[model samples]
Target: MDDRLRERFAGLWSRTIGPTGAEAAWRALDAGYGAAGRHYHGWGHVADLLAGHDAVRALPDFAGLDHDALALAIVFHDAVYDTGRADNEARSADLLAAHAGDAAAEAVRAAMAMIRATAAHEPGADPATRLMLDLDLAVLGAQPPVYAAYAAAIRREYGAVPEAAWRLGRAGVLGRFLARPRLYGTAHFRDRLETAARANLAAEAATLRGGPEP
Candidate 1:
């Protein structure tokens, strides 16, 4: 809860979706998905991604884009996340439309498209989308303790699933993450964190497979 982040969120709230509506929407989302619920992809996760995106922006050669739109997208990326639901994106889009009006609604839809596109690791996706997706998955490259906590949070979010099913599903996700050429395709992230990210993913994958630490 940095002051700058709070200010930024307030600005984003006032700009796209009027202050009152944004406040209400955020409160609803916060109450439903905040830390108390142990939601892995909640406000804290969005805040982390926003911070990563800002860090990326400071790198040389980073072209400026629609910061507000991207910020809004990040906030709502997991707005409708449900471990048992297959239509999270659609549901998120609907919620954004209802709460934020038409323009913000469209932005949410685009964000949803970007999110779904990342699942396939599409080669032709836009650079902004790539960066956003990478930031979303950046937890995988965090320090072991941080990553372990993230893993536990995710497990809690998906607690409805049986342990065996959760393990297999999680392993499949890590495998897909490993298949990517670079976790973050942006030049800055590739230069600074790619090796460490790969090592982290590899270690996690090994642990998932019940192998000794690397």
Candidate 2:
């Protein structure tokens, strides 16, 4: 899977910034996602996002989506992740913008916006943006065991946080998503994963609060 992702991303990067830059960009991406202390926001998470992106490319709604820009967004969205930092998304976007070089100005801007929007998981007017956000959040709708593993990985990422604080913070984040009218912005994701995502969030929230096993 890692090798496949490398080939896919290398191809996209070559198209975006030329072959000369693809090697360095791939090295940076691999190092960033493979960095120490990353339990959840790692290469595996990026791979999942890319898989979700590929899964929906055939949908009519995504026909107009900027495939290259969306791919860039997925690859760089969490490239600067840090549990102790609040500006990872901003930094990640900046990192992409720096490496974008002479890539199409519009595509670079669009990718940066999509990367930043992941901070709040909010969709903008663009269909690509909506799809990007949805793909980044696809894990929310994973099967119960998958979702449980994701939750555990996140907890491990924040291992420095006190248990009480981590539980409260994690539950609060889940509650905010649950409070939204819809967790998924794309109709495709909503139709397929909304119910499952909601159940997963609620279950995780309950467990966080020490209410019951789910």
Candidate 3:
């Protein structure tokens, strides 16, 4: 959220997504999703991911390209998120095409592909995709209070599910995350956040099991 980052994000919006349409998309995101929904994967999430991306600048042979496209992808990645539906990516892609036009449509498609690749939990995927996925789930390693708030917000987003169902489903999701060789594929994140993320996941799993809180 620094001025330089904000300016970069703005530039991405203006050049890639169009200022007018981007503004409209922002309005739609804010109004349609409400504040809590926004917190789940909104501007804050995009900013966090961008910050994480910036953190990996020391990687060798990291020739940055099409950052505007990546930025657009981050912005729209969860644009149509719905807990009840399994095709959020498709819906998000559709919305991006409708709102941002052809170039953004392609970017959205590529971004969705990258997002879906994370579902495999493989360690050997494209480095950028791995980094992006890690950033998306970076909250797993956040301070307890922050992670707790995010956990509550995510639960609220899926309020229709019963507590038992939510607990089981969420534990399954977190288990998959913990099963990965590294919580974050980037060397920086692997070194700095991996242990914390595993600890957090274990604590969350305990809570899901109705054990004592951490």
Candidate 4:
């Protein structure tokens, strides 16, 4: 699977940025995502995002989106993830822009915006960015077992946090999402995932708060 993903990324780089720095960029990506402390925000997560992008690219609803730009953005969105950092998205966007150089300037600009959108998962003014946010958050609406594993992986990523602080912080994060009127920004995702995502957030928040799971 990693090999397949690496191939896809290489093809994207070649198409978007020519041959320059492609191999070095992939090596950077492999090392960054394969880091020992990365439990969730890793290569597997990148693969999932890319797969989701591929699944939706052909849909008429997303026809106006720049699919290639979205693909590049997805590939680099979490390329600099760190559990303790607040600027991972910014750093990742900068990294992509640097590697892309001046080639595909429009696409790179769009992709950079999309990459930054993951920082808050907010639906900004751009449709492509909204979709990117939705893709990053699709795990929120996963089936119960998958969602459980996702949540556990997140916990493991932040394992250095003391138990009490972790619980408080985790519950706070879930509470913010639960309080939102809609978890998914795009209508396609909202229709298909909103209910399940809400239920999952509520249940997880309850568990984190020592209340009964919903």
Best by TM-score: 4
Alpha-carbon shift of residue 135 in model 4 (angstroms): 0.8
Taking all chains together, the TM-score of candidate 2 against the true structure is 0.94
TM-score of each: 0.82, 0.94, 0.79, 0.95
List candidate 3 segments past 4 Å from native: 1-10, 17-20, 32-39, 57-61, 104-109, 115-124, 211-214
Quickly count the clashes in candidate 1. 0
TM-score for predicted model 4 compared with the true structure: 0.95
Top lDDT hit: 4
Estimate every model's Cα lDDT from 0 to 1: 0.69, 0.86, 0.68, 0.87
Model 4 ranges with Cα > 4 A deviation: 211-214
lDDT of 1 by residue, 21-57 (tens): 7667776566545645546877688789888877767
lDDT of 2 by residue, 1-214 (tens): 3688888888888776666677777787778899887888989888888888888898788897789889998999999988888999999988888887767678888899998898888776888889988887888999999999999999998999988888889999999999999988889999999999999999998888884345
Q: Which portions of model 2 show Cα errors greater than 4 Å?
A: 211-214
Candidate ranking under TM-score, highest first, comes to 4, 2, 1, 3
Q: Which ten residues in a row have the lowest lDDT in candidate 3?
A: 115-124
Candidate 3 C-alpha lDDT tens digits along 8-45:
65677677656566556666555544455555666667
RMSD of 4: 2.1
Report residue 68 deviation for candidate 1 (angstroms): 0.9
Model 1 score (lDDT): 0.69
Candidate with better TM-score, 1 vs 2: 2
lDDT of 1 at 28: 54
